[model samples]
Target: MPAEWEPHEGTWLSWPRREGISFPGRYDAVPALWRAMVTTLATGEHVYVNVGDEAQEAEVRAVLFGHEAVARTALDASAATSLATTVRGDRVSLHDRVSLHRIPTDEPWCRDHGPTFLVRDGELTLIDWRYNAWGGKYPPYDRDDAVPSRIAELLGVRAFHPGIVLEGGAIDVNGRGTVLTTESCLLNPNRNPSLGRAEIEAYLREYLNAPHVVWLGAGIAGDDTDGHVDDLTRFVAPRTVVTAVEADPADVNYGPLRENLHRLRAAHDQDGRSLEVVELPMPGAVEWEGQRLPASYANFYVGNEAVLVPTFAHDNDAVALDVLRRCFPGRRAVGIDATALVWGLGAFHCATQQQPLAVHT
Candidate 1:
């Protein structure tokens, strides 16, 4: 599978429905954030969205048109610098670098339910791991489970189904043969009680073609997906990774994050080289209605020319961006305000999937 940091042709997103189960009371604000994200992503690479039908596509186009106008208005010389961080540094025209596909979806967490793209010898393929709504926390995920097949049909590529439940958010990989994941999510009985760690690793090796699997411990507090590595750790390079570390000993995430750090420190890449691990700061707890949400700087999405980071309104937002900037020297790490977006328990990385740019002869 192509690493998240690799150049992409486009990013795939499932537009949220007004009646979807993802955002209960925050639905009204969700689409606006999506538009902002789309605007930023469209300038660098194509933004593929799944709209259910003609009306939904029209609604999405209207939103895109309005945002495009905002982007166009910012074409002034002084506005260029500011919009570079907010959306894009260039103008956004209607139907520009975006393709609307009519596909039904139940939720907007595309990373959890989207097709995991793979490439080999200038050809692209997809792997459709089973999706059970993060081990059945939410029911009636039929539409989500079928998304990979629908995407494969649209792309005209062969898709393989491993028949074991896994979410794209659960694993992060280097373009090489190293894959990072957590035991808490994959080994959860609700998803695949029948398989053991070795068995699951074997599947990951075979499907992702990444023989090196680095297993971390649990996830942060309030993460519905038991322990998604994206919320705890992610690969920043072929032999390097940045993991979330909580300083406060009394915090719930401290012990688990430290344990994962220890594991990463001792981990090695496919070539048997020790990994260079970087520690990223964790933001202060973000809660909504008395419930702590899964807010982490590690949940950053790498696009073609930019890395979209989920930044909470915290001091660490700047720190995370700076650290990621150093890790990804070639790509700019753009932070998005995820304070309101995380009300759905995910951030920018969770809402999108990348399609690698196909190599041409």
Candidate 2:
């Protein structure tokens, strides 16, 4: 698997269904967020979206083309600026860069259900890991589980089934042989009870082409995915990881994040070099309807020319953007307000999956 920052032929997203469980009562507010995400990403690389049916595809077309009026409830003023260049007349015409496929999914969290693109012998291969909807927390995930194979068939590529349950969001790779994940999600009896740590590691090494595995402890507070590492840490470089840290000792996330920080500082890359750990501040606690949602700056998505960092309108939004800008100096770091999107317990990274640029050998 290639690092997210690597050149990508495109990005994939499963459009949120109005009846999907992710956004619940806020489903009306999610499409605008997806539009903003797609528009920003299409400016850099091709964006492929999956819709459940022809009707859903038509709905997505309207949303992207301005045939329908999007309620800008989720995006803040900055998103307006980000959407400016991509717009034409009343429509955001990314006709050349955006394509919608009739790949149905039960939910819109594609990173957890979408294809994990891998390059093998200079060709693109996808891994179809068994998905149990965060360990059976969500039922009727049969459709989401079949997404990888669906996409493989569509693209005419070889698909590999690890046969074990693993969400794309659970792991992050450095593209140079190192993978980062958390023990909480992978080791929890919920995900893979039949496999031990060693067995899981073996699968990751064999499938992801990552020989080094750096394991973190727990996830942040209120993350429904049993602490997905994408919400805790991400690899911004071959040997450098930008992790989220909570400054308030009283906050529930402080201890676990601190422990993860310690582990990253001690972790080494496949080349046996100590990792360069950069600390990114947490966006405090994001709540909706009296329930806390997992919101972290670490959930930013790296595109060909832009880093879409999720912001919660918090003061630290600028700080997180600055930290990431420094980390990815060559890429533009744009903060898209995720206050409404985080209600679904995810941000940019959870909804988007990268399709690495094929290197024909």
Query: Highest lDDT: which candidate?
Result: 2
lDDT of 1 by residue, 12-108 (tens): 9999888887788888777767876776677678899998888888888777764533432212233335444544334544266788999888898
- CA lDDT scores, all candidates in order: 0.84, 0.89
For every model shown, what is its TM-score relative to the native structure? 0.93, 0.96
Q: Give me the displacement of residue 311 in model 2, in angstroms.
A: 0.6
| Per-residue lDDT of candidate 2, residues 1-361 (tens digit) | 9899999999999999988888888887788889888887887899999998988988898888854333345444655655563465434357778999989999999999998999999999999999999999989999999999999999999999889999988999999999999999999999889999999999999998888899999999889999999999999999889999999999999999999999998889999999999999998988887888899999999999888889888999889989999999998887778887888888999999999999861
Off by over 4 Å in 2: 67-79, 89-93
Give me the overall lDDT of model 1: 0.84
Query: In lDDT terms, how accurate is model 2?
Result: 0.89
